[model samples]
Target chain A: MIEIHDLHYRVGAAPILSDISLSLPEGSLTALIGPNGAGKSTLLRLMARLEPLQSGRITVEGLDLATTPTDAMARTLAIMGQQNSVASRLRVRELVGFGRWPHHQGRPRAADREAVEAAIDAFGLQPFAGRFLDELSGGQVQRAFLAMTFAQDTAWMLLDEPLNNLDVAHARALMARLAQLVQDTGRSVVAVVHEVNYAAAWADHVVAMKHGRIVAQGAAEAVLTEDLLSDLYDTPVEVSRHDGRPLVLHHHSHSRIADLSRGRLPDRARLS
Target chain B: MRFAAGLGLAALLALMLVSLGVGAAEISVRQARSDAWTMLVLMESRLPRTLAVALAGAALAVSGTLIQSLVRNRFVGPDTTGTSESAALGLLAVTILAPASPIWVKMVAASFAAMAGTALFIVVIRRLPRREVMLVPIAGLVLSGVLGSIVTWIAWQADLLQYVGVWMSGEFSGVTAGRYELLWVAGLAAGLAWVGADRFAILSLGDGVATGLGLSTASVMRFGLVVVAVVSALVVTTVGMVPFLGLVVPNIVARVMGDNLRASLPVVAASGAGLLLACDIIGRLLIAPYEMPVSVILGVLGALIFLVLLYRRPAHA
Candidate 1:
């Protein structure tokens, strides 16, 4: 389990996160859902120690994040950010092989090699394993990065905007994979998901944030309500049940023509 | 891979023999094999010169590879990043302040100066928005120009222009067995690079990813910076500045082998050594008896290669 206490992050004078505290359960798929500038990525970066904690205490799986060594923390949790600009002549297989670095350091044993191959297979990247990253499309490259993070083989995985650039099919496939990982391997997963339906469909726990504060956090069915989402995003949202889970239907419901015909211009459209 | 390395080794040996035979002193391979005086000349002058050329080339190229990986910019190298120029400044300062200092003292001074200069370059480039790939080397070139002019002005004021001139043109004509042994230290630094090849490769993946992969990015970056500074200082102190050997060799290797330093570093080193040996041979042959500096030949060739790299399809970020 990951625990946070008294976390307050600021950039210069402007606060990014303030007096935040939360606990994430182990062996569950958790989704961090928020609009832009919600500090979802920043919070994840702090937990992973990619960003230094200013006035916060975080512990991941019993190890203090501030005191743990980088290699030790790496074995505990693996993270993949949205922007992976590895601009070099790197093959997809070689890039994924780097995920085994914490385990093998430099000298890869047979077990490490097998793990790399397994990760490549897990992402279904075998067809383009030999190809360079630049040769692949954006979605394919996104999958390759996901494979690399999986090859890390940690107990916890944190991904920031993992679905970016991925088409709908790949996105759904990745969410299914994350769900399967949590169930089959008992590894805890935390992902910042922009698409709420993904979190609605797969996330066991839903954390909704607005203005750097968690507005609601609980089981997916309880937290992803229409009233909470509409309040969280400052826009109308509708939720319907599908396959015994909450399915958010906010896309077509907030049309501009319907709003103008109703004679009151939307506040968000005016500001933008 | 093993076969390629073996073939490279065989070719290097063959080139070393040829380089040892051809020099201003007019000693053939057969003569050196039979005559004792010719053999002494081969061991003392020709052998040292050849080894110095190879070692310096390999060291510069390795430093270039390290800088490129650390900066995550393909265009920057020791020469472009003001490393060589600042080393010259250190050499000049030592020559003017303490003319009787030991060679090692001068090398230490130069290495310290090179480190400071490179650190400044890194700091400046770090603040830069990294999207524009061409801006990095352009920034480096500006830094090099500034550092180089300062050295030149100081040399002129001290009436040490001629001495600085000797250090500026990378010529192996003056290299003797005892004078060129410092290059071995540079060679050792390159060897260290090979040992830590995987770490450096991870480093090229950027700070966040490298950290996520369990690396102390700062420490590894410092290690690489020291390697680059030490290699640059040694090369400048030993044979003056050999421009672009570092930039050209690794790039060509990367084109064929990609940037997996573990698989490609040895090839980068060997190719660097081989290319420098060939260039030095060309320098000796071009103006027979009266030799041109290897820097002159490398300057022209390196510039051509740089242009080609610039116009070629953009490489990965």
Candidate 2:
């Protein structure tokens, strides 16, 4: 389990994340959903220790983040952020091989090789294993980075906006793979998702944030209601069931207030 | 791997010997042995100068490779990092402040100053919120400019401008046996770097990756910087500042070869030696009795090569 308490992050005088406290249970897929400037990326970076926690306490399985060595934390948790601009000269296999670094420290053994190969196979990257990262498309590069994180083989995986540049089919495939990892392997995953439908369809737990604070969080079915999402995004929204999941309809032409005002016009409203 | 390195080593030796033999002096092998004075001049003057050039070239090249790897930047070098400039300032300080200071004292002072400059660069880089890697070399260039101006000002005030000019214009003319002994420090530094090549390569992956791999990023960076500073300082103290040998050689080697430090290190070293020696010979032959500085030749050639490299798009790795 990962726990964050009294998280207060400030960037030069303005508060980025204020009094944010949350706990992520073990063996679950939690999707962080929010609008722009919602601090989802900041929260993920803090959890990964990519940014220092200024006024908070974070612990993973009873080990305090401040006290645990980075290598030890890396062995337990792996993070892949949205910025995947790695030096393009590196080969796909070499990039994935870096995931084994925390274990072998560059002197890879047979087991490390096995893990790398497994990760490649898991991501269906065997065909492009020898290719350089520059040679691959954006979606293929995203998969390669995901394979690297998977190769780390940690208990916890944190992905920040993993679906940014991915096409529809690839995005669904990635979500399915993450869900399988959580369900079958009993590993935990936390991903910051921009598209709410992906979260509603796939996430076991949904966390909603606005202006750097969590507005709603719970089981997907409960927190993903129309009222909560409408309040969360400050826009009129309607939720309908699709394939036994909440399908958010937010792109309608008429506003809720406009519809209500027209309904009160009685027989004259039907003249048009 | 060891066998391949040995082959490279043999090649470097042959190049070194051939470079020593062929120079403007044109001393035939038989005549070199017949006259005692001629033998003495060749052995004492030409031999040490050649060896110093080779050692300085190799050291700077290796140091440049290490710096580039540690910073994960392509254009880094000892001069660009302000190391050689700071070292020159250190030497200048010693000459002005302590006129009676020994050569060893001056070398130590320069090494320490170079280390301090590198540490300052690292600190400045760490403090920036965005952590722009390009700023490192820029900061280094700024520091070099500042330190270089100070050195120049002091040298001018103290009437040591001639001495400073000689040191700044890198050449092999003044190198003799006693003066060239300082270059052994560079050799030792190169050896140390070679032994820690794996750690340096891991460091090229950035601090997070290196730290995640159980290596202390700060310690590794500090170690690599010290090695670069010490070697660069020693070379500057003995011969002078040899520009572009460090930057151009490593980049060319990495382009031709791969990023693997262990595999490319010797190639960088050899290429550095070969290029410097060829430049030195060209400098010697440019004028019959008088010769241009090796630094000038290297500077012009390096600029042309750099422009060519810039214009030519690199093929994807």
Q: Kindly give the number of clashing pairs for every candidate.
A: 2, 0
Model 1 lDDT tens row, B122-220:
998998887777788899999999999999999999999998887788888899989999999999999998988988988887887888998999999
True lDDT of residue B297, candidate 1:
96
Which regions in candidate 2 have their CA more than 4 angstroms from the true location? A252-272, B1-11, B28-43, B120-142, B195-199, B211-215, B288-290, B313-317
List model 2 lDDT by residue over A55-161, tens digit each: 98999777798889987888988888774454424567877887887887667899999999999998899999987676788888888888988889898888989
Top candidate on DockQ is 1
Query: A16-48, model 1: which lDDT tens digit per residue?
Result: 998789999989999999899999999999988
> For residues B184-297, could you state the per-residue lDDT of candidate 2 as single tens digits?
789779878887776787677666556544567778888898899899889888888888788888888776655667667878887788788888878877885677899999
Give the DockQ-based CAPRI class for model 2. Answer: acceptable
TM-score of chain B of 2: 0.91
- Candidate 1 residue A181 Cα shift, in angstroms, is 1.9
Tell the DockQ for candidate 1. Answer: 0.62
Error of 2 at B84 (Å): 1.5
